[model samples]
Target chain A: MTGAPMPRLPTGIAWLDRLTHGGIPARRLTVLLGQAGAGKTLLSCQIAAARARVEGAGTVFAALEEPPADIIRNAAGFTWDLAALAGEHFHPLDLRPDPDMVFAGDFDLRGMLATLSAKARQTGAGLVVLDGLDTVLGWLASPARRSAELARIGRWLEEEGLTAIVTAKAERHGGPADALGPLEFAVSLVVALERREESGGTLRALRITKSRGSAHSSSAHPLFFSHNGLEPLMWPGGDAPPASQERVGSGMARLDALLGGGYLRGSTALLSGPPGTGKSTLAALFAASICAGGGRAVHVAFDEGPEQSIRNMRSVGIDLAAHRASGALRLIGLQPGRDGPEQLLSEILAAVETQDATALVVDPVSSLMRGGVADLGQSAVRRLVEEARARGMTAVLTSLVEIGEDPASGTLSAVSTIADAWIALGYAERGGERNRTLSIVKARGSAHSNQTREFVMSSEGCTLADVYTAGGAVLLGTARMEREAEERRLETLAALDHQRRLRALEAQLTEAELRQRRSALESEAARAELALLEAAEAERRAAQAERQARTAASRSADTPAEEGASA
Target chain B: MSAAAVALFVAGGAPRSAAALRNLTAAIAATGRPEGTFRVEVIDVLREPGRALEAGLLATPSLALTAPHGRRRWFVGEFDQPELLAGWLGDVLDGEPP
Candidate 1:
């Protein structure tokens, strides 16, 4: 060991490289321990092929258990062309023991080492893979001998300045030589592959049990075997996509209004509801919205195939088929039972990459939980959302909640907790009909409506209408329609009654005006009559006074007239 | 006369290779085979590593025996037990010969 740090050789697998903190230490012995059929051989071959293909570094692959031809054939199944890399940059040595060969007294691995060294020299190999080392160790009768051989191999690898990968079978039930046996102490790095039978399917995980002089992830990472090769699924812990302030439409204007300007770009939105509650329809609408805006979108349908999803969405006026035909949308249908969460995520991510999608919709993401590994599914969904956000893609994920199950609880809540917006869809059963209802349970950093709108889907499109509340109960379906009609009727009757009362008040005012006019006229006539009577009386009095004055005294008449005038 | 070919693969003059070669010679002498009946070839893997790889040698001091009928048998390790080596050679040489 030197004071200088060991240089790293990347395995060409992104997540694996990240897990090992830059891949295995170069020119050091690394051991792979796994049970039978646990992909030890495949992984080692991939590492060798990657070294040859990526760095163009020469590599030697020693097949101790299988023939070189079989290794080559199996390598062809992957995307790498191992057969073409043979003889120049890549050298394969068949060291499988002959069945007829017998051990005489004592032997070492000198012949095998010599052959390897020769091949390494020929190709200038920088890496060597001793696949199925357990088979070679099995030939030895004693554990001490096996340990010695392993140490010898390790020293030889170090002296040759070659990175080496040795694979061995992991024993079960804590046997004396369980798995690593004495080889664990001989290598600088140890990677263990595991296969567990889950209710959904077989789950494969890779864990780095030991790494000397390097910081690495200690937890087991789910493995996905795609056409390319094995990939470790991990939530990237790198520079996250900057928080986007942009908002994108959810296709339905009213729904957008409820969400306070639609969904935030590069954010995750959870649409949770029971079956037939239009969760898929809403997700499709989101996808269609992105596509209609000339943005590429990916819709992963877990419950149905692409054609079925297209047809079903078409019935709800969410023309997904049109978007798909226009190359703006890609539909990926996955069966939960067929693959684990890792494979599903890989496929979905692959689709996103190929389509260069900016928006993604996973209909009923809760279906991933059916794999019987809740933790795995949850982590996978988290990774999916994180990856989507890292690319600044708006992700609309649908989760299926049991009919009476609370959307805020259960396994689906794990998804909702990470989502920026959570829209809970349910059935508001009233009047013998179950009407779909949607409520924005949460919309972070936005002023969203708290009302639960009645979600209606028709041949035209999906729409959100205000839910009618009568008394204390929320009305929906035909009950809401009937209530609206009754309110309209009551309004009309009230209007008519008001009009009648106004007309009667107007008549009363008119009559009162006419009566006041008649009274004034009568008063004026009475006054005039009184004045005429008075004048007549005055004339009569004047006549009588004149007769009396003519008889008594003209002077008294004059005085009376003067007194009257003074009064 | 039977023509049986035997090849010895060793890692150049190592102590194990010398012991294996000496034991093999003594074992053949004990088999009492005619001199022309066997053709022996000694290949030092350290000197000619390609020959060792071409022979699919997995250990030093390995003995590869081929009969006239092309039937082959391989033995690995130094033949420190001369009797065991002699018996194995006798079985191969006593087989159907050309």
Candidate 2:
């Protein structure tokens, strides 16, 4: 309620404090207990590395488990020059319990503490971090001893007003018994780093397991391990929502007619379909149209890079590279969901502002879905669309829908909820060749042509021609419709010759059964069969007997009689 | 540390990065603590700047932990969490909430 009464909360990381409540409690020692690879070292190093200029209170990093070289390597990943912190104010105390002694029974943490305390006191350091507690605790003769040591360390740091943090491995730690263990105990603060599979990639997560002394920021920051170290993700919200901008057309005549007039500038349209549906080509053509209409467009690709996308679009007669060179189109190829949703959102916003983009396309929002993060991605993508809309830029997102997934999967459904318009694209065989069709399913507040438009990409570029009034029904979602059409064609052909399909089915079934029988027989022989099978008696002898004889005969009893009888 | 360098570094995911910010505030608060004129409440917003925004901060690297009751004032913008928090504490408990 009232302002925090502590002297001042010194956040180990300044940039983190910029996103946190204020800082960790100034008088209490917090424990950042997390899983391995949760970025504990990264977080601690940032604090340790910042001390050279932290002012008044010096900081010491007591790295006991990791050798100085490994520490340096890890710090380097965070882009920190730990060596530069020496003397000017930063100090790294290499208190590594001997690697050999780490497992020995005679490990004394109190002595290590004494040395650390002396070093901290001498430097007038206010912040101290035991690079982690697990390494040191494992040195303890017993879990009880380990627990006692942490409790003592916690009390000393809290009483001395030396803001401290002891990094610990996140496993089954202690309980509410004393001042030790994981989240169940009473620590001034607790931070957990967890690596979660997200969008098919690993997401670095920083969860505030607990923060006791004062009110704290209670959000889990989506984090990433980068060349520099553990970085917190920015918020998904755009810097400042862009005021509504002008109206803009998608530029594909048939596609535009389907969507009433054209897409609203800043509105979000979702394009969903399977491969060969021309998702990328459609996006490229829209981008080209925007460029031709006197506005800039940016394409941030995840499926393919700029070169491939440019080349492919050129095959369709849309020369994106030209537009790029002319300054009307800016294409940035991003690695597949290489970043979390928030990070991706920031990158888009940053790119848009830097390029003064009036329109943007993310070709295959499905790329955002591939990273192992299932639930968060949908929200993140939706937020991205919202951000694009807020920035007053038309956002056209392409999604890959497996024929089976179109009707049921929650991904596109979630995306559909956020889209201002829905367009379905697919390949349909008219003669003996496949042609692409772009159908607009919904467009809010606009009169969309109730027709599926023929879209083609040849040596020139994407072209929208005639609309098909009787393409069966537009919402068959591609695969089913194609399969049904193929069935009808086959039926017509079969009407002329009924026996062809029957013979085909019988032969196919016989071939399949024979294949299964042969495979099963071969595997059984490989497993234990030794005797050669006598075709006449094979049916009488069970499969088990056949296997044993086969396996045994293969090794011994040149037994040409057994083989001859089987033949 | 250069502000940009610190930012890029903290954004890297250093948990201790917050400790450094806290010590910064405490150190400056220590300079002013002897007088016991005002207390500072600091929140590390590195993982949750939404909290910073809730406090009405539009830009990060900006501080809002000040009050001044009505008499004095607080301004936000700095790379240091502690040192910056003090400038605001001087306003808090003395003026209207920021």
Candidate 2, residues A448-547, lDDT tens digits: the string is 7756766666785566665423456433324445656777899988786787878899999999999999999999886654454455466666765666
**lDDT, model 2, position A121:** 62
Winning candidate number (lDDT): 1
What CAPRI-style quality would you assign to candidate 2? Answer: incorrect
Q: Model 2: iRMSD?
A: 21.6
The top-ranked prediction according to DockQ is 1
Model 1, range A411-517, lDDT digits (tens) per residue? 78788888889998998877678899999999987898887889999998889886778797778889888888999999999999999999999999999999999
Pairs that collide in candidate 1 are: A171-A179
Evaluating just chain A, the predictions reach TM-scores of 0.74, 0.56
**Residue-by-residue lDDT tens digits, candidate 2, B11-61:** 113344354455445744554644434344454444443343233221222
What is candidate 2's CA lDDT for residue A342? 46
